[model samples]
Target chain A: MKNRYDIVVVGAGPGGSMAAKVAAMGGLDVLLVEKRQEIGSPIRCAEGVSKKGLKKFLPQIKKEWISCEVEGARIYSPDGTMVEMAEEMAGSEVGYVLERKIFDRDLATLSGDAGADVYAKTNVTDLVLKDGVVKGVKGKHLGRSFEVECNLVIGADGTESKIGRMGGIDTTLKPIDIESGVEYIMTDIEVNDLCNFYLGNDIAPGGYAWMFPKGDNMANIGLAVLGKYLIKKNVKRPIDYLNKFVKEHYKDGKIVSVVFGGIPVSRPIKTISNGIMLVGDAARFTDPITGGGILKAMESGIMAGETAIDAIEAEDFSENELKKYEDKWRPTIGMKNERNYLIKEFFINLSDEKLNDLARSINEVKIKEMSVTGLIAMLIEKNPKTLENLSEILLKYL
Target chain B: MIYVDRYKCGYCGTCVAVCPEAAIDLLETFIDINDNMCKACDICVKICPIGALVDEE
Candidate 1:
C-alpha cells in the first residue's frame, strides 16, 4: 500500500465512507481507515433514517439495506396515553428502518469502488503535525505500525473522537450535552408497522425511549438519558432503565443483540482548522431533538469531500480555505442543530404533568394536519403561560 | 478480575459493547462483572472513556 495519499478519512462510518467516496470520485487519492476489524460490527445506532434523507445522498438504495418500512410513529406519554401521527404528518420524513450493518458495509464498498483505498483494523494513534498543520496520521494496521501522509485529514470518528482532539480541537462535552444511550435488538414479540417513542421523566429521565420495529417480530429498543440527569438521580447506567422498559413492555421478547454508545446533543463545535476537518459525531452533528445522525453525517461528509477537492485544486489548504466547509454546512444543518439543542433543553426540563398535558392536547387536536412547527405552536398556544419559554425558542422556526 | 470504579463510571456502556464475553452488566447502581464469564481480555480497560475499569492483579 502507498504510504501517502492526498486525503485520509478516519473512521468507516457513514460520514467517513461518504467523504472518501466523493473525494475518490473527484479523482483524488483518498484513504479511508477504520479501527474495527469489520466496518459495521458492534453497531452503535438505533438504525433508523428517513427515506427522503437516504435518497438525498444515495439515490439508488437497495432493498436489502432496508429492514422495514414504517408508515407512522406512536408517541406515548407518561400516563400511557398515545398519539399516533403519520410519517407525512410528522414532517421529518422518517419512513424506514435500516439494517445499519449492511448499510455501513455497502457504503465502504462504494468508496472502494470509487477508487479510495479502504483499510480496516487500522487504529490511528496520533496525528502527524508540522508547524501546527495536520500533515498525516500514524497508526497501527493489523498489529504493525504504519504511517500515511496526506494533505488533509477528515475526522469522522464518532462521539468519542480521538482524531478531533489530536488535531487540537477540544471535543469534550459537559454532562448535560451528552446522552448516554443503551439499546437491545430483540425478537419473538409482535409489533405494529410504526415506530414508538415513550416520553416522560419517570420513563427516561431527560431523554426518550424508543422502539423501532425491524420486522413483524423484531425491534431495536433503546433509550438515551441525559448524563447530567443520570448523575443527579444517582442512576448508574441507562441499561437499568432499558431493562425495566423491556420487562414491562415486552416480557416475551428474546434478546438477540446489544448496543451501547453516547450521542452528542450539543451544538456543533468549531470543527475546522488548517488541513483538518471534523464531520459526523466528531463534529457533534447529531439532531438534538431526535438523536438521529445518519442523515446529517452523510450530508456533512459529502460537503467535506467536495470542499477537500476544491482546496486541493486551489493549492490553498490553509485554515481560511477549509472554512468553506463550515460556511456551507453551518447555514443548513448547523443552524437546525442549534435550534434543536434549545428545544431539547426546554423539553428535558418539563415535568411529567406538563408532558401529559402536551400529549392530551395533541390527542385532542388534528395531528394528521399539523407540521412539527404547527404542533409546537399548538402546545405554546394552549399553555401560553407555562410554555412561554418554549415559545421564545420556537419563534424562528415557527 | 475487572475492578470498576463506581464513582468514575459514566455508564455509557462501552465496556459492555466491546466485551466479547458479555461479562459486564450495568445494574441500577453499578456495573457488575461476572468473574466466571470474564476472560480478563483487558478490552474493557482500554475502551473505558473515564478510566473506570481496571485490571486487578
Candidate 2:
C-alpha cells in the first residue's frame, strides 16, 4: 500500500470493495483495507439476496457464490397462518442464498483487478484530520503501525461505524432502531426450497425467526430483535429466543457455522461530511423491515465511487462537492430507506393480535403480488378498522 | 461497569451499534468496552446474543 492515495476505503465488505473498484475503474488511486485477515470468513450475514438485484449490480453470477436458489417464501404469523408467495413476488430477499465469503472476496478481487491496492488484516484505529477535514487514516498492518494520507475516506465499516462517528457523521443507532441478530448454519436439517419466516412477539419479540435454506437438508436458522425487546423484558438475550425455536423445530439439525451481529434498522444518516462518506451498514443502508443490505450496500458503494471521482476531478472534497451523491442516492436509496423505516416502525409496534388478524386476512385470499406494500395494502382492504391507526404511515409506501 | 466475557463474546459488534454512549468497540481479537465511556445502562448486555456482556453489579 502507498503512504498516500486519492481515496482510502475502509472495510472490504460489499460496499467498500465496490467503492474501491468503481473509483479505481475511474482511474483514481485507491487503497482498500479490511480488518480481518481473510476477506469474508467468520461470516455474519443471513447470506440471502435477490436474483434480480444481483443481476442489476453484480456483473454475472459465478457458480461458486451460490448456496441455493429458492423458488419462493412462506411467512407464518403468530397464529401459525402461512402466506405463500412466488419467488418473483416474494420481494427482494427471496431468491438466492449466497456463500457471502465467496461473494465478498470476489468483489474485492474485482476491485484489485481494477487497480486498487487491497489489503486484509489492516485495522484502521484512527482517522488523521487536518483543520477538521479528514486527510488519512492510522492503523496497524500485519502487526506494524501504518499511516496513509488520502483526500477522502469511505467508511464502509459495518453497523458500529467508528469512522463515520469520528468523521463527524452522527452514526448514532437507537436501541429501538437496532436489531441484534444471531444465525446458525445447520446441516442435515429438514427444509424445502422456500425461505421461511415465523413472526410472533412471544417467539421473537420485536423481530422474526427465519430459515433461509442453504440446501434441501441445510439452512441458516436465525433470529433478530430490536435491542429494546431484549432490554430487561424477562428475556436475557437474543440467543435464548433462537435456542427455543431450534428445540421446537430443527432440533435434529447439526450446527455447522455460527454468526452474530447487529443491523441498523434506522433511517440513513442525515449528511455526509466533508471528506468522509459512509456506505452499507455503516450508513444504516440495510433494509429496515427485512434487514437485507447486500444490494443496497453495492448501490451506495457505486454512488460513493462515482462521487469520489467527481471530488478528485474538481479538487473539492467539501460536503457541497459530495452533495451530488446525496442528490443521486437520496432519491433512490435514501427515499426507499425512509419508506421502509416507516414501515418497520409500523410493523414492530403491532400487537400479536393485530399481526395475526392481518396475516389471517392475507391468507384468506391469494394476492396477485406479494411484496411488503402489497401485503399491507391487502391488510388495508381486509382489516381497515384494525390497521386504521397505522394506515396513514403504510399508505405512502403503497 | 459492564464486563464483557471475552471467551463467550462472538465479536459480532452488535453491542457497539446499540451503545448510545458509543462505549463498546470491536477490537482486533476481542471486543473492548471502555469503562470511562460506559454509562452502565446495560443495553449492550441485554442485546448480546450469548449474554457475554454483564453489568458487574
Candidate 3:
C-alpha cells in the first residue's frame, strides 16, 4: 500500500466514504480507512432517513438498501394517545428505514469505484503532526504500524471521533447535549408502514422512544435519553428503558439484533481546525431534536469533498481554505441544527402533563397547514396558561 | 470483577465496541460482563460514555 496520499479520510462511514468518493472523482489520491474489519458492521443507527432529504444528494436510492418505505408516523403521547400524520404532512419525518449495513458498504464501494483506495481494520491511532499542522495519520493496518502522509485529513469518524480530538478539536459533549441510545432489531411482530415515536418523561426522559418499521413483522425499536436525565432519573442504561418499553409493547417480538450508540445533541464547534476537517458526528452535525445524521453527514461530506478539491487546486491546505466547508454547511444544515436545538431544549423542559397537553392540541390541529410557529401559537391559544413557558420560544421561532 | 452502575448506564454499548476480548454483552435488559472473557484491561471503563462500568477493588 502507498504510504502517502493527497487526502486521507479517517473512518469510512457515510461522511468519509462520500468525501473520498468526491475527492477521488476530482482526480485526487484519496485513502479511506476504517477501524472496523467491515466497512459497516455492528450498526449503531436506527437507519431512518427522509426521502426528501436523501433525494437531494442521492438522485436515486437502490432498492436493496431500503428495508421499509414508511408512509407516515404515529406519535404516542405519555398516556398512549396517538397523533398520526401522513408523509406529506409530516414533511421530512417520513421516508425509508435503511439497511445501514448494506447502505454503508455500498457507500464505501462507491468510493472505491470512484478511484479511492479503501482499507478496513486500519485503526488510526494518532495524528502525524508537523509544527502543529496535521500532515497525516499513524495507525495499525492488520497489526502492522504504518504512517500515511497527506496534505489534508477528513475526520468522518462518528460521535466518538478520536480523529477530531487528535486534530486538536474539542469534541466533548455536556451531559445535557448527549443522547445515550439503545435499540433492538426485532421480528415476529406486526408493525405498520408508519414509523412510531413515543414521547413522555416516563418513556425516554429528555428524548423519545421510536419504532422504525423495517417490515410488517420487524422493526428497530429504540430509545434515547438525554445524559442529564439518565443521571437524574437514576437510570442505569438506555437498555433498561428499552426493556420496559418492549415489555409493554412488543411482548411477543423476538429480538434479532442489538445496537447502541451516542448522539451529540449540541451545536457544532466553532472551528474544526486547519488541515483537518470534521464531518458527520465528528462535527456534531446530527439534528439535536431527532438525532438523525445520515442525511447531514452525506451532505456535509459532499461539501467537504468539494472544498478539499478547491483547496488542493488553490495549493493552499490551510485553515483559511478549509473554512469554506464551515461557511457552506453553516447557513444550510447548521441553521436547521440550531433551530432543532431550540426545539429540543423546549421539549426537554416540558412535564408529562404538558407533553400530553401538547399532543392533545396537536391532535386538534390541521397539521398540514401548521408551520412550527403556527403550532406554537395554537398551543398558546388553546392553553393560555402555557404562554409563560412558551412565549420566549415563540418570540425566537415565530 | 467489573462493576456496572445500574443507575448511570445508558447502555450505548461503547464498552462492547472498545473491549478487545468482547467481554461485554448487552442483554435484553442489562449488560452482562463475562468474567472469563474479561481481562480487566479497563477499556470498557474508559470508553463508557456515561461512566457506568468500573473495575472491582
Candidate 4:
C-alpha cells in the first residue's frame, strides 16, 4: 500500500511471484501485482514442469501442487511405433503434471511469507518514468487509476505482455514462431501413467500431440503446431485438427474441460532493456519445440530477482546492469530454443512421405533402447548419409 | 458468423460442466470443442458464462 518500494513486480504468475519472493527474502521492500483477482485463474499453459529444474530452487517438494508424477515418457511414431526410455535414464529432469492454480497461489503465498506485499486485481496501465528510466507503474485498481514508485520494475506479464511491448522492446514473433494450441481434459479413460507424445502431420504439423495423465481415468490431451504449419495446411484454427483426433481416437471418454491458447515458439528476447527486465512467457522463454515453459519461467524468475536485488542494493538500476540476467538464462534455455528452431524447420519442411519415412527410420532405432548418446548413434547408423545434413542442421549445438 | 473470443473463454468446465454426453473438457487454460462429438445441443450455449461460444444455425 505504500507509494514506493525497493522492487515492484508486474504479473503474479510463476515468474513474477518468484522474483518477488526472492527479492523479499533478500530483505528488500517488494510489491507483486496481478491483473486477475486470482493469481492462477484463467490459466494459459500446458502445466508441465520438470522435477530436475525445480529441485534447485524450492529444495523440498510440495505435494499439493502436483497432480501426477510422470515417471518416463513415451514417443509414438506416425505409425504408432512406441519408443520409451526407463525413468532413471531419461536424464535428470523427468517432470510432473501440476495443478497450476495451486502451484501459482503457493508461489504468491511464498512471496507474502518472505515479506513481499501482494496485490491482486490491480491492472497496470502504463509505466512511470523518471529521468528516462522506469521508476514505477500506473494502473487502475477498483476503478481508480493510481501510480506507485520503485527502484526497479520486472515484467513477467506473459507472451503478449503489454509492459514489455510498452517498454519499447520489439517482442514480435514470426508466424512460424507462434504455436496455436488446443487441449481437452477427459475422464473415464485407460492410459499408462507416463506422459505420451504423438507425432505426425495429420495430428499436428511442426509439432506433436501430448496426452498427460493427471490421475486415474483422467488426462490432458492437447496439440501445438506452428502458425505456418496451420496456414500451409489451410486449417483455420489448431482446435479443428485436435478435435478431429479426439473423435477418431478417444471414442469412449467424456471430456471434462477444454483449453485453447498460443505458445511463443521462439527464443527469449535479446535485450529486455537496462532498467526493465522481462521474464517467463512475456520474454518468450518457452521451449520452441516442446512449448513447455514452467522450468524456464522459474529459472528466469530466479535470475531476474537476484539481478533486481543486486541493482537495487547497488543503487544503480541501469539496463546495462540488468542485461546480466538475460545473459545467464539465454545461454541455456536460449540455446535449446535455437536447436528447437532448427528441428522445427526441418520437421515442417518435410513432405508427408518423408515424415512417414522418418518415423520408420526412427522405429528402426527403437530410441528407447538407447541412451541419449545411443539414440544419436542409432540415428547415425540408419541414416549414414544424413550425417552431413544433421551436422549442418545441428552446427549451432556444437 | 460463429466464432470464439479467445480472451474471454477460460476453459472453466461449465459448458463441458453441463453437457449430457460428456462433450466438453477443461484442458489447460482454455477449451476444446469436439465438433464431431457435439450434437449441436443448446446446452453449451446456455451454460457458457462469457458468451464465448455461439450456435451457428
Q: Which of the numbered candidates is closest to the native, going by highest lDDT?
A: 2
lDDT tens digits by residue: candidate 1, B1-57: 889998767655556534556566543235779999999977666545445787998
Task: Kindly report the interface RMSD of candidate 3, rounded to 1 decimal.
Answer: 8.0
Q: Over 4 Å off in model 1, which ranges?
A: A87-94, A369-374, B1-57
Cα-based lDDT at residue A123, candidate 4: 73
Candidate 4 lDDT score at position A109: 92
Q: How many residue pairs clash in each candidate at the backbone level?
A: 0, 0, 7, 15
Q: Output the better candidate (1/3) by TM-score.
A: 1
TM of each candidate vs. truth? 0.87, 0.96, 0.86, 0.83
In model 1, how well does chain A match by TM-score? 0.96
TM-score of chain A of each: 0.96, 0.96, 0.94, 0.92
DockQ of all models, two decimals each: 0.09, 0.76, 0.13, 0.05
Fraction of true interface contacts that also occur in model 3: 0.09
Worst 10 residues of 4 chain A by lDDT: A364-373
Best by DockQ: 2
Candidate 4 regions off by >4 Å? A88-93, A231-234, A364-378, A393-395, B1-57
- Name the top TM-score candidate: 2
